[model samples]
Target: MEGYETGAGTARQAVKMDMPADQPQTPIDEVIRTAYDNIGLERLETVRALVPRVGMGGLSPVLLNKIRPLFKHTHLVKDEYLFQQDDEVDFVYFPENSVISEFQMLADGRTIEVAVTGNESAVGISAVWSTSSAVNCAQVCVGGDAYRIEKDVLERELTYSRPLQRWLHDQINAYIKQISQKVICNTHHAVEERFCTWLLMLQDRSRKNKFNLTQEYIAGVLGVYRPSVTCMAKSLREKNAIDYVRGQIFITDRSKLRKMCCSCYSELPPRRVF
Candidate 1:
């Protein structure tokens, strides 16, 4: 926090971080090292592999080392507030091993997640688009590491670099597809449909059928009571729709799940949720 400048046009407060030779490197250290090795990072090694439907093999190697140097490594523990509502946006983050959720609280005191970003996605669009200071309440749901850059620097790179710009467009398009599907699901699907669709989406991202979860976390995202999440999860399991144990939910019956899920899952053709 000390010896830092908040903003200075395209310029950022730069400082060298020392890795002590005496101390062993942490997991965060390894992620940083691996990121340098693989321009295209595989999803499994990232910390955010806990969630489903978030598997992203990001960046081609040529671009990986090229762009990797532009980013600074950052870490956030679980449940930590990354950015509060109305905070100024300085850095745009591409999470390598973390899951960050963007949500808004309603007047009735309910919170709804607008987007859950990790491997395949980019964050801080409003900063680059609006060029404004204020930001929304985006928190860390899963603890992990990220590559961060100043907003101005990111925009400048996107503007002049055609390859980076194309990559940005592709990433943004993926998110647009997701948000569009979520809208359709929220409006027309039944509760069971919505639940399955959500689970399937999570699975696709995390690249795993089994994941750590709490009923309360599901309830928060679904905008329902904790008990409701438990009951519904129980319902799905009883019907062999899924298997839940020790914070792990496994979908054993994909056939039944797709049947039970709304058209959003099957009809829309998700990117990689199979």
Candidate 2:
């Protein structure tokens, strides 16, 4: 059995840090001011349009316009690290078309995905009240466009906006629910069932039928051996639930895949947190 060793090493090597250690960190206030200055009318409109779509429907237009300047559009790539474990989160990412996965690394160096964040919610929102350092490692699972705001800027806005504060608390509750369910699924479900559930969840977040993911990567995310993923993939293919060639996986039959998935799949919020 090829355990997490090889897969984990590959993930570690593939991680592209947003900020390099050699680069001097800019002051947060200055970064915010610069982003504010660079904000264009079109960009602000784009951000405002995305707000309601991403579960912030209650935010007033006035509030949205006020903070629109604080946002900076960002394009993230696959395998990019938003923030590593124990590192202070400098920005909160709101993925418009991207999917971000948060993993908890074990003492033995193994890791398992605990939560996934996509367009429905933002990542690193816990930085509002939680510790400065991140508890899990966050990485881009599917690459695309996203919007980010400086942590300090978001914190400052939260102080006076009761709606925003309530929304953040609701998001945090949903996050906790997802993580708790993941634990139950990992502990009680079969690998095949879990694989099906994961595929459905990924498809929901990425809004794509096909994904560029390898068996090793799937194994690492599930904390299983590479061969286990291979077997499960083969089984899924035989059932016409999915199809894969090398690093690419395509959902061939959504109905069949859903049938094979565990109850956990139906339990998750629809078109919301994964």
Candidate 3:
């Protein structure tokens, strides 16, 4: 896999170099070059990190070609609010490079994240199940490209595709598990365990062992004070599990962190995603 050459012929060239005359070629041949391949993957790296199947939907050519335009080019600003709690819930978003956070707002004006949306799946589910609004508010965590579709459109077409429906259900199930476990971890676990759990979850969608984060936001997600988060992060770092510096977190040893985390990491909330 030195390169991403997608050739199925005697000879062909990649985006970096063309093949000689006796070669059979396909349009994808050149695009699979190492440099070009990375550009493609980085574009949706966030999405793939979560679902791992965004590029494999394999929709029929007719259907894909028709809907492809809808997603091929879309944009959202960094830190933009996509929607809020109790909105009409008429659409869901498939973010390409962005990270979307779903939170529940408490009466005290604090919010707790229920799920995070990145690649391979839609962010908000309001339109998916025809619910009015389940998200307190969703914001762009990474601020990148996003694909959006009306809820009605996906629902109508979903009836004809079992695979797509199944994928959607899987995403929902993951969301519920995230929210439930986070709630229990927040309520019953010690701060250190909660910090480790948060790191474990974030590790799933980050591009590197080092991540962009802050204790202030972690506190918001956990519905706790900033000092509490700072204390836990410090303890984890002291244990050689992770390090925090200038709004960034570096995971030193994943296995150690997993071991240090609580049992909620093992016991997830039971809910039907679909």
TM-score (all chains, Cα) for each model: 0.67, 0.77, 0.65
Q: Who is ahead in TM-score, 1 or 3?
A: 1
Best by TM-score: 2
lDDT of each: 0.60, 0.72, 0.58
Cα shift from native, residue 266, model 2 (Å): 1.7
lDDT of 3 by residue, 179-236 (tens): 7776777788887786676665544433335555666677767777777776677676
**Cα misplacement distance, residue 255 of candidate 3 (Å):** 2.7
Q: Candidate 1, after superposition: displacement of residue 105 in Å?
A: 1.3
Indicate whether candidate 1 or candidate 2 has the larger lDDT: 2
* RMSD over all Cα atoms, model 2: 14.4
Please give the TM-score that candidate 1 achieves against the real structure: 0.67
TM-score of 3: 0.65
lDDT of 2 by residue, 13-104 (tens): 11122332332486543343233223322243454455445422223557657777888999999989999999999999988768899999
> Model 3 off-target regions past 4 Å?
1-69, 72-78, 129-131, 143-146, 266-274
The full ranking of all candidates by TM-score, starting with the best, is 2, 1, 3
